[model samples]
Target: MDSSFKGILYPTRLPSFGRFPAPPQVHHLVSWFWIPEWDIAPGRSSRQHLIAFAACNLVVQHDGVELSGPTTRASHQDLSGKGWAVGALLRPAAVPSFTSRPADLRDGRLMIDAPDLLAHVVEVMGKETTARGAEAAAVFAAWLLERVPQVGQEALLANAMAESISNNPDLVRIADVAQQLSVSTRTLQRLAVKYVGLSPSALIRRRRLQEAANQVRTHPGLELAALATQFGYADQAHLANDFQRFLGFTPSSYQKSLTAPL
Candidate 1:
């Protein structure tokens, strides 16, 4: 852990973690890869709280592999002992390649057994937990390439919609996104729910709150009213409500916690 670091609800940078982009071949299905290696001191553990994006993840630990779905609210994980994890951040729409119903796993997780699409990747990640940097990424990418052929067109479109949502900060309404994509609002909602495991409005809200959290962290003294207006919130209260709903903390309190000493 960074000694100077204080409490932060959404940690963009972790102390002993590494994230790498996926290779071109599987880029559409896989967003990025992450590895976290940690050795918590005796009688000590670390907990990280996060507002998970509208996406799924394939995580490999020493015990076995697990498929984690998108979370609707805040989630956390406790890190203890000497442990490590190799994780694949799957594109929201690409969830079908691994599971039939993305929404079924929302705010929940499932175990990966043999005879599934992820078995081979699980096998490889089992052996590569100690591999670092590009070596671990390469091993994961090679496995993903074999399964790329299974990704369908709906997943591709869903991934593109997710990209659009995350990239456009000014997007406030699902109707606006539907207009931009030349689709009806109902169609867009169906696609999002089916592929991304979230409604378009939910996705927009998640992205906006994420931006707000980053702004609060980077500029601790920034005015909440101004930040709220800048990010399309109706008012500071609206923003604070979202922060409380999704992050379990108000923006001001979150900033205060971050600035406080460890």
Candidate 2:
């Protein structure tokens, strides 16, 4: 289970959210499964903000399923009524099963025609049990396993590229990632476009920004310039520019907002 709120911007305002690791059988296909259940008062709304991971997600809700592509900026969802969503943070190896032109679907989503999958997950979620999250993730993993039984070598390489860029903060440049993965820079770019929708540089930037924001929120007294140095930004101004561009607020403002009265 992943309890850390890595990409979520406002953990304090979230509803019931759970993130479970993918089963070993489907580990190559799915990074993890996340579920967010929300119930708001009448005439009020709870807005959830995020700088989503630089990867696609297959989300299953009450109505149907959706394949959400990678994002380039901050985004939010307003929940006004009772609802829940079971989402799979798909790995690069599994993206082709859902969409081939992932680059075209950047910052967008496509409706998936998977009624049986939706029904099965919904049934498991409706069950009265304490392990709804784990059970629902298991069923989701089972469905994915049935759909994508075998992963190709190139697809596995793409997954390796994504994992390298995401998990290694030292990989601040496309060349660094390419060298780490022992692939040419051109090959890395092609893999990212075909599987991740975002460029390798974009993925690195998103990871840095997310880490910087998390630090700002958790370590309110930390100097922005020091954070920038730690994250490989040129300076404090660069970090502030990233925050303003992606999150629409400077680091100081964000930190102040965190401690502000509601």
Candidate 3:
């Protein structure tokens, strides 16, 4: 553990895909880490699994494009961010001309990737803490500060997209809001694609899927047809198709086994 970073154990593991078959266990866990200055983490080392990282400052040095849908280890590196999903709203940096969409920005943080940024963070944090506790957290924060920009318009747009999803997870239409903003639907789509790393529709669908799954888990008795219709699916088949693609489990099986013990 590293003392430079304050580590707090999160209660559940994040949602992800790595193993061919989904793991039987799922817990929501997050590590809150802090780094006062710039630091760097090496790029991912060809490993399985996705990790999520958040920070106030981030930069990029590779070919990252904002893409929607399942991102692989080799490709997930395309999207990145520097702040909380909610906090990016108050920032000023413009959207990245390029980025990696939907992948964990803080996953696989390594010091060798950006040395100058790492130098900046170590200078801010004052000392190393791997001698004590929170080593991963400290190094991770430093790594983010080294890579992500502290402020950007992309952050704001991402925040907006997030807020939009939160308000109505099932409804996402670029035309509705973009025209309201006096921007073309194309412009909004571009913004979401470039800065937020999701098409407006994709973000909406992602949020809806999350909400739908939660409903399924919490209300196992609900009919799939009803749930699917409520969430904007054409019918049960549409819902089932999406559920399998995103979660790796059929909705019925996922619900049936929910109480079998993780």
Tens-digit per-residue lDDT, 61-141, candidate 1: 767778898888877888888877878888865577678787898898998763443454445545654554556677777
Each candidate's clash count: 0, 0, 44
- Residue pairs clashing in model 1 are none
**Top TM-score prediction, candidate number:** 2
Task: Give the Cα lDDT of each candidate.
Answer: 0.75, 0.91, 0.40
Poorest 10 consecutive residues of model 2 by lDDT?
A: 1-10
Q: Tell me the TM-score of model 3.
A: 0.49
Candidate 2 segments exceeding 4 Å error: 1-3
lDDT over C-alpha atoms for residue 17 of model 1: 75
Model 1: lowest-lDDT 10 consecutive positions: 1-10
How does candidate 3 score on lDDT? 0.40
* Residue 94 of model 3, lDDT score: 28
